[model samples]
Each structure stands twice: as C-alpha cells, then as structure tokens.
Target: MKENYTILAASHISGVPTESIRAWERRYKALTPQRLQNGRRSYSTEDIEKLSLLNKLTHEGHSIGQIASLSTKNLKNLYQKHSPQRHPLAEDLIKHLHDFDMEKISEIIEESKLTLETRSFVLDFAAPILSEVGILVENEKMTIAQEHIISSILRSHFGTLLQISANLKPQKRFIFTTPEGDFHEFGILLCAALCLSRRIGIHYLGPNLPAHELIMATKMLSPKAIILSVARLPKDLQKVDIPTYLKEVRTHTSASIPIFVGGDGYRPRSSADKGIQFLPTLAEFDKMLENFTK
Candidate 1:
C-alpha cells in the first residue's frame, strides 16, 4: 500500500516547510494533496517525492517558478545535475536493495568500514546510505522488508564495530534510548556507535522504553547524560505534544544530568526544559561531546 502522510510529516520527510507547501499549492500549483472532509491536506508518497525533488532542486539553485510544475522524473534528472555527488555510495546500496542482494550490501558496508575511518564511515557513508534507503522506502521505491533488511544488516555491522573497542576506558558515558512511542532503534544505535568511536561509553537501551523504567535505569546506572532519540512525530496537529513527553522524562531524572533529545522529527524549541538540550545532528552531537568533556 502506498503511504499517505500529513502535511507536517511531508514537511519532515521531504525537507520542505509547511508554509512552503501551502504557498506552492496556493501560488504555483506545485502538487495537489488529497483533502479530508475536515479540510486537512493528506500528502501522498508521490506528493512527498515531488516536494522532495523540488526542495532538492531549489537548494541546488533552481527556482520554484522554473521547476514546480515539472514531473518528478524531470525534477530528479535536474537534481542529479546539481547534486552530482550527493551520495555516491547511496546509489549502490539502494540498487542492492532493489535486487535483494543482502550479501553485496554487507560487502559494501564492510568495505566502507575498512576504507574509511570510523567517524567518516559512520557520518559520511553509513549515515547517508541508510538515509537514502529511508527515502526509497518513504517514496515507495523499495519495500518495507527491504528497508528492514538493510537496517538489520547495518545494525550487526555497527555492533561488531562497537564491540572491538569495548576494552577501551571511556572518557564520558551516556544512556541512549527512545521513549515508548518511538520505535526506531537505528538512530540510537548509530549514535552509540559514534560515541563508542570516541571512547565515550554508551549504555544503549534499544527502543520503546517506558519513562518509569528509564528513570529507574538512570538511578541505577547514574550515567553522565541521557540521549533520547525521536525518529517520528505524530501526524495529527493535536498530537504534536512531544515536549510534554520530554518534560515528563526530565521530571523523573536529576536536574544536574543533561538530557539531550534529537533525531529527524525533533522540532526546535526553547531549551527551557531544565537539563534538556537538543542535538539535532551527529556533527552537533560531536560538538556536544567535545564541549562536555572539555
């Protein structure tokens, strides 16, 4: 089944702003959405692909006036011209996905590990390929099963990498997890692998962790910090209440322990929630680790 997403979700998936989507609809007739009886715009995966293409082209110097009406295929052809090197490794991984060649996927991942340094492997190559797989799945170019296969294989790769350095004494420690509503584990796993690369110990508690359980673990482990990852936000406008969940988690933990929240779905908000800091990307996370250790 083709996936249908809300405008907000589309904004996140396509890297387009909600305001821009509305403007494009009203002004440029970029792409029409299916409207509900209540007047909410439901964006299809195809709509997301169009918006994503538009967003990529605009970023690469194309004007909306010139390309907003173009088909998704045409926009993609133009985008490749602009971002010729967007993700060189991404294409091969995606191709392997389409072919159901898990062995070749593992070969590419392992080769990346041996050729690139840990940070480059994780940030530059691994991250981009996984993100592209996510896009392919989101845009319906790949099956959900294919996405899971890629993720599971990569997860094993990361596990081996993390284990090799287990004997190294860590300079800092953190507990990485997601709340009960967020089921994505790859984000935190990647985060853990990155931290491990820097000799930063991470007590990673996979996903769907309850707040009370997290609070209990915090008390038991007394980690230097907590890193909560949220990979998806609620699509309903009325349900975008993740801040409340952030606050609830904060309430159960110590004010002195810095809690960081991040992932694709995180929205920018005031860091007024005591001890809750948002690190939106791995680069920012590296800076955070550097600053914390300093």
Candidate 2:
C-alpha cells in the first residue's frame, strides 16, 4: 500500500526545500508526486526516503542534476558503501597513534585496509578521511610517523591506481601538482584518482613544485589544464606576490588553458583574481570536471 505525504510533510521529512522539490519535479522529472483529486501533490514514503538521501548527497557537494538521475536503489547503495568509512578512521587512528600501540596500530591499519579497499572507496570517503588525518597531525594528536604510515599506505594505493589509469586514454592530458612550498599532495593524488576513474589523461607532478618549473612543464607538455593543490600558504609566502607570479606564468602560456587551484590554501580571499579558479575540495573539483565533460 502506498503511504501519502503532503508537500510540507515531505519537505520536513526529507530536509529539501519545498521549492527545490517543485523544481526537481518540473525540471528533472525526478519526483513525480501523486496528485489528489483536489490538485495537491502528495509524496509516498519511498519518495521521502529518496529525497532524504538526495538532500544528503547534495549537502555533501554532489550536483542536484547528477543526483536526480540516480535510482533510489543506486542512492541507497552509494550511501551504504561510503557512509561507514567517512572520517572516523582517521580520528581513531590518531587516538591510537597517540597511545603508540604499534600492535593495535598495525591491526587498525590492517583492518582499515586503506590500500586494499581503496578501489571500492569513493572520492568522498578518501578526501575527508585524509583531511582528518592531516588535522590529527596538525593538532599533535598523532606523531609524524603515524601520519606517515597512513599516508604511505594511501600513497601506494593511489600510485597503483594512477599506473592503471595511465595505461588507458591518451586524450586531453592534464598535469596536477602542488604549488611551491605547499607540501600537501594528498588532494592532488585524489584528483588523479578521480581523473583515472573517468579515464581522463593526467600526469601527476606530485608535491612541492616551483611555479617556474610548472610553467616550463606546461610549455613542454601543453596539457589541457594545470591543477595546483595548495593545502596551506606559509606565512612568509603569503606576503609574496601571487598575482605577479601568475602573470609571469601567463606570459609563457596560451590564455585559453585554464589554471585551477584546489585545497585549503586556495580558499577565496577576494573576487579579484580573474585568471584563477579556486576549487575547495575534490568533490567540488570533480563537479567542475563533470560539467566540463558534459
């Protein structure tokens, strides 16, 4: 038997804006709420659950357009698969790291199976988890060795995927790297993995690459895009002329090639930069890629 829920009731249950629900129905044919003889739209319980999951995914930085196309079953599958391993492991790993329990840490690492389970783990899982691990180190909850252990496992995991992806398509190459003095490359590696999943051609430059070298590499390879991952700007470097350096690189490259900046350091300072696009997270970056491909 179908259970009926009014628009307001459904909105309350699903946490979706009523207007958004209306728009989804009108634009995407996403949710076809039944019409009563009196002309009010009424949603079923199944509809409510689907809309709830859709709201969760949208809040997680997925596009409404993409979510609209997924079946209820697919949505459930995605949620079930990714929700369990989101950020808790990194937090727990840090706690374990503080205790210096090598045996337990080894057990945790083995249980986490970061390398073994990486293929099935989505980008949403990996990026936040890594970020959490970084925070643990930054907060001194874990020693550098513990962080390195987890990072080494992830590096090997992503490195294997990168190798496999490298063998695929040869079209539209991109070179990804971290800017000068920015040592964080986990985001860059995750981006590489995402590109791999899509079979997009990419050459990863790893971390701590100078701008001049990046420009020179750009001139040599002529990649479709140059992605710079800047996790944090050192205090000394913050005062350095970012615009001047960007302009310097621009002089040597075609104006059409897009330069995308990602990670924490690239967070918006002002709306002044016309040439650079700041991508805050891997999910946001992936959406940009999706739109570009479409």
Candidate 3:
C-alpha cells in the first residue's frame, strides 16, 4: 500500500513551508496532490521526495520557476551538481527517519561510523542527524515515542564508543548528567560522544541525578570536571529552582572542581550564581575541553 501525507505532514518532512508548497502547486504546477473526499490536499511519498529536492535546489540558488517541472531524476542530478560534498547517507537517513524504519536508521549510523573518523562522524553525521530529528520532534512531526526510539539507539552506540575510547590513553575525565527535574538525555549523550572522540574520559551518570546523589558521585569519582545538561521545563514540571539547584551542587562539591552546564533550560538568573560555567553550545563545550587538555 502507498503512503499518503497531509500538506502539513509533507511540509514537516520535506522542509518546505505549507505556503510554499501551495504556491508552487498553484503557480507552477510543481506537484499535483490528491484531493481527499473533503477536498483537503494529500501528498504521496514521491511528492515529498520531489518537494525535498526542489527545496534543496531553490535554497542553492535555482529559481523555482525555472526548475518546477523537472523530473525527480533530473532534480536529483541538479542537487548533486550543486552539492557534491553532501553526505551520501543524509538523504537516505532522513527518509528512514520519516518512515520510522529503525533497522535502516541503525544501519546507516553504523555505516557512517565505519566510513568516517570519530570526530568527523560526530560533527558531520551524528550531530546533524540528532539535530534534524530534534527539529522534527519540536515541530510535532514526530512523537515523543519516536524520539525515544532514536535516542535509545544512539545512547547504546555512544555508550559503547565512550567506553572504548575512555580506555585508550584517556586524559581528563568529566561527569555528565542532567538535574533531578530534567529527563532529556540527548544533549549530554552527544556531549559525551564529542568528549570520547577527544579521548576525554567521561563518567556518564545519565539524566535526572539529584543534587545530593551528584555530590556523592562526585566525591567517589573525583573527575576533573562536572558537566550538566538542563533542557527546558514547563512550569508545572519544574521540581526545583535552577539557581537553587546549582547552589546546592556547588556548595557540596569541592570548590576546585569546575562545573560546566549547558542546554536550553539554563540561564544564570541572579548574582548568587558562582563557580558555574555555562556552555550554551557544543562548540563552546569543545573549546572548554581544549582548554582543560592544555
């Protein structure tokens, strides 16, 4: 059976706005979507692929009016001509992401790991893949369950990667986790992967580590640094104030141990915050890693 998608779903999957999709269809006849019984537009998988190609070409400087009626094969040739350096697996992985084909997704990830070096795999492939899936989730194109499925697969692979690298001439070690109220793990997981690629030993404590427990773990592990990821929390879901939480962790932990925090939910709200380093992006975190090694 062929799959059919509503205009909104097509927009989400194809990275084209609904307004643009309609404009292209109406003005240029770029696509001819099927009309449902109630007269709503429904796109097919093929239509989405064509739209994705068209979107890519338009962003790369092609005029929509000039290329709207090209065949899919011709559009793909144009895409390659324009972006020859594009990762080979990206388009395939995105298709599988939308299709929810877990096996294919895992296969593509494994293939990329084998083909690219650790740093390249993380920067070029893994990071982009996670970011795309995250956008899909944020746009409501994918459900939380789908996000969890991808996360679980990535966590298992990254855990293994971290363990293998940490055993090989590891330098400074860092403890990675989220606070008690924050349950998201993807941010820290990617961070840990980057650290591993740099041969930085990581004792990943996973997410939602209570302040007290984190203190105890810190004492036992005595890592060179502590890294925390705090994702955005709805008001009703917040268990403790972030500033207070940071204060508690700082107070109990050794003053010498540097604490680095990152993610969307953290912003130093007041002057009381001290001894906490906020890294807003992975690039910043990597820079900190370089400083530690020096």
Clashes of each: 0, 0, 0
Report the lDDT tens digits of candidate 1 across residue range 1-294: 345688887887678999999999999999989998999999876787799789878877888988999998778656644554434565677678799987887787767767777766677777766776776687788889998887887888887766775666675679989877678777787778878767789787878787878899999988899998887654653232566667888998888888888775654332345567767567678787777766
RMSD of each: 6.3, 12.6, 12.4
Model 2: how far residue 94 lies from native, Å: 5.8
* Candidate 2 runs further than 4 Å off: 1-122, 237-240, 269-271
Score residue 278 of candidate 3 by CA lDDT: 74
* Model 1 residue 121 distance off true place after TM-score fit, in angstroms: 1.7
Better of 2 and 3 by TM-score: 3
How far off is residue 290 in model 1, in Å? Answer: 3.5
Write the residue-wise lDDT of candidate 3 on 172-202 in tens digits. Answer: 7889999997888878888888788677888
Candidate 1 least-lDDT 10 residues: 232-241
Give the least accurate 10-residue stretch of model 2, judged by summed lDDT: 264-273
The per-model lDDT (C-alpha) reads: 0.77, 0.71, 0.80
Write down the TM-score of every candidate.
0.69, 0.61, 0.66
lDDT (0-100) at residue 110 of candidate 3? 81
Quality of model 3 by C-alpha lDDT: 0.80
**Colliding residue pairs in candidate 3:** none
User: In model 1, which residue pairs have backbone atoms overlapping below 3 Å?
Assistant: none
